[model samples]
Target: MNILILGSEEDIHAAHLKKSLTEKGITVDYLDTRLFPTKLKITWQAITHTGCLIFPDGRKWDLADINKIFWRTFGGVNVPKLTDSYQERIAVNDSMGLLRSFMRSQPEKWVNSWEAYEFHKEKPLQLSLANKIGVTIPATIITNNADEILEFSQAFKDVIFKPVYGGSHTQFLTKEHLEINRMKLALSISPVTIQEFIPGTNIRSYVIGEKVYSAEIRSSSLDFREDKRAKLIYLETPEDMKKQCLAITKAFGLKWTGIDWRFKPNGDFFFLEANFSPMFLHFERETGCPITEELIQLLTS
Candidate 1:
């Protein structure tokens, strides 16, 4: 069987998946969206969608006949503008819209289709669904009123705020901005989401197909990702939470997911967030688990 992995050059997970698929004797192809072409044609079924993709080299691929697509981060494409003009940048912006049209046209196997994954991206929706599934989630508030913020802070005392739509972590400026404004969250254009910080240990639960692996993250700081300068402790979670992780992923219609949970001093658990696509190497590094191998098995199955 043939499998197509769609992501950017910088996607470590896709690369890991490639290696695992090769070892499992499956034909694998990489299509970096940034390398996608500016003018493409695809005739699937009785319909056709024609558009252009500003590929890395101005090259295009006719993508109507592809079998399976593993969609990843959209902004992964980094094609430098030839003219550095506003019009040129606008063209690049339009390329993603066209790409979305084609990606949804065919009824093929998608590793958690964009449509399915997008629903979980909304922080409010995720928590709502998590609550319905008997999962314990931290009390959350999404609002612009300063009074609301103060009220939440008073009630929770220690609250952590984050952007509803997150940006790339590789960028230093984005990280600094998030950390700097962790208090006010006033300048935010969109509604800010704040949760009562659950005290205790942090865990990243990875669900790949039916298998579940939990990695405990211990940091002496407020946010682990914030202070990388701090020490980190990683370990596998207990059996009960492992099952809950799987249940959370299934509840969200995700074939694969990374769930963050915090355990309080009183033995209570709080669901932080469910990441549609999260880093896997950290889990592998902390625990000697074969995450990539499991992904390859699911793809070929």
Candidate 2:
């Protein structure tokens, strides 16, 4: 079986997966999206009515021929020294757009298409989906109006603010004591998402095909990255929690994803969000789970 592990050169999990699949006698190839040249051609095949991806190097990697495609990253490269944003945007957009169409052509096998992977980038949409799946979610509000912010703050007393779009520019999930100050509204020009603080323990559920594992993450600070002094610990999750993790992944049409579930102080599981392509090696070392082997089995099956 031929497998393609789509990711960036900096992605550690993708590297590990490639090693595991190779050990299992699968022909695994790594395609770093950043290495894709600025030029690519997409042609519609009249016979199949599907788009074909042609690399600038003249190598043809057909989507239909791939036994499995583990999408490790999507739309994450910055063309260095580009003066024009339009040019850079076009290059990245075209690559991902073509890649998305290619993946959509496949009807079977384990694959994480760009469309399925993109669901995690939107926090509000994820929360809505979680609610529909009978998973507990915190109360949230998105608005730019000053009056609305004040009202929600007064009602909820304690709230956490995060960006609607996921990016590294801002921080996430900082536990703040209720101190309603209306002037903070002027900090941004866009609508801000404020949610009721769901106090709980942090748990991450890693799902690859039918193999699912859950681990509790313990961090002293609300924003784990903020305080370097803070430490992280991983603990195995109960069997019932593993079932919930699997259900969440299937609902997202995802064969591989890392789910973040917070156990609130009230002894309940609240769905935070899913990481479409999460790092597995480090987690496996901490939790002692054989995620790499499972990925290989799915591709080879």
Candidate 3:
């Protein structure tokens, strides 16, 4: 069986996965989305139900021969430098749309299908599903209304705000932030997600199939992603939490995922969010977890 990795060449995680899979004597193909339609060629025939992908290096892969795909990241395709920015934007959108449709057509072949990732990536949807599955979640409000936000803030002494989409960092809503951005809030055009601050040790659980590798993260920053001083230590997965994680993975139709939770002093756990394509190099490097090996097994299995 052959595996295809859909991500950028510069991605370290992708590089690790490819190297490991290759070392196992598995046939692997790499496709960088950013070079689509320019350095790569895709041919498909609806009547024959056949498709072919030609890589930039002149390697050819038949769709039927590819047993699995690792959809890591779908970066923007490179477009010819154009004087008209709108045209370039249109070209990018068209390329993405075409690729998405093709991937969705073969959802069963993806590690975590593109359709599942798209559906679960929505924070509100995932939170609702988590709550239904008996996972504790912090009180969250997604809104653009200034009055509503002010009222919501009254319920919690501390709250954190983040973008509804494409936000990599989290920030606390301090008095200074409120006062300085009061005008901007009043005129806000986009909605933001605000959640009551839950204080505790951060736990990152990397779930691949039935295996779970967890790490307890201690960080001084509000968002651990920005905390360079953070430390990681592997923790044995709790029986109940392990079941819940598996349930969540199945619910999202994901074969692999990274789940983040906050463990309160009282031993209560609060669900933060699920990462479809999580960065696992840090955890593996710090704790020596066999994440990449597990990922390869999941794909090949």
Candidate 4:
């Protein structure tokens, strides 16, 4: 089976995955989206729904022959440095649209299809589904009104804010931060997701098909990503939690995912969110997990 990986050349995770797949004697096609239009071309037939992905090296692949696609990153198409700003924006938009259509044409071949990722990327929707599945979730609110946010914060006493959609980092809203940024909040145009702060050990569980590998993250910073002293230690996931993680994976139709949970001092785990295209190279390196191997197996199976 031939596998296509969508990501930037600079992405370490993508590079490692491609290397692993190649080492296994599998055919791999790496598409750096940033090089779209300039170094890549798609000759798509509307009627037959078939196409050839042309590379800059005079090579091509028939879309129908591609068995699997691993969408690690949907990087923006590169626009010329010196060009009309308006025209550059238009070109970027058009290129992205064309790429989206190409991926949608063969939705079934993706590890986590764009459709599924779009649905699962909404924090509120994912949290609701997780709560319905018997997973414990923290008290949360999504609002654009400053008054509503103030009320929620007052009720929770200590609240953290994150982007309603994925990608943006999470931050704890301290009294000082809120006081200083109160005026800016009122002028905000988009709604924000705020949740009650849950104190505990951060646990990241990676679900690859039926296998679940977990790690405990220890850090002093509220957002572990920015923590300089962060450490990862592999751990065996509890049986009940594993079932919930599997259920979540199935619910989102995800073949692989990284689920975040906070193990509270009270001995209960609070579901945070799941990332469709999570960075696993760091986790694998730290814990020696066979994540990349399992991913290759899943793709080639």
Best by TM-score: 3
Clashing pairs in 1: 37-53, 37-59, 37-60, 38-52, 38-53
Instruction: Score candidate 1 by TM-score against the native.
Output: 0.78
Compose the digit string of candidate 1's lDDT tens values, residues 1-301: 6667777557887887777777777766666665543323322333444432333444444453344666656543344576768876776666655556666664346777776667866878888888988888888887766667666666755667777766622111123433436634644556667777677977777788888877667676666686565433555566777778888877787788888888777777788778877778767765777777777766767
| Runs off by more than 4 Å, candidate 1 | 39-67, 76-98, 106-108, 168-188, 229-236
Model 3: how far residue 266 lies from native, Å: 1.4
| Order of quality (TM-score) | 3, 4, 2, 1
Residue-level lDDT of model 2, residues 1-301, one tens digit each, is 7787776456777777787778878777765555544544455565775554466677676655667777876544434546898987887777666555555667364467666766667778878887887777888777666567667776765577776775532234233422234335443457677778777777788787877777767776665445555434655666766777788788887887888877866668878778877777767777778777777666677
lDDT tens readout by residue for model 4, 1-301:
7889998557889889988899989899787777888888877788998987888898889999899999898776776654688888888888888888888888889988988778776779989998998888999888777767777888976799888985678888777646627635642767788899998899999999899999999998888998877999998998988999999998877889999999987778989998999999889999999999899888988
What number of backbone clashes does candidate 3 have, counting pairs of residues 3 or more apart or in separate chains?
0
Cα deviation at 63, candidate 3, in Å, is 0.5
Give all TM-scores, in the order shown: 0.78, 0.80, 0.92, 0.90
Residue pair clashes in candidate 4: none
Tens digits of lDDT, candidate 3, 70-161: 97877757777779999988987887776666677688889889777787668888888989988889999887776677778889989998
Could you tell me the lDDT of residue 144 within candidate 1? 65
Name the top lDDT candidate: 4
Query: In order, what lDDT does every prediction score?
Result: 0.67, 0.68, 0.84, 0.86
Q: Which residue ranges in model 4 land beyond 4 Å of their true spot?
A: 79-94, 166-169, 180-189
Worst 10 residues of 2 by lDDT: 169-178
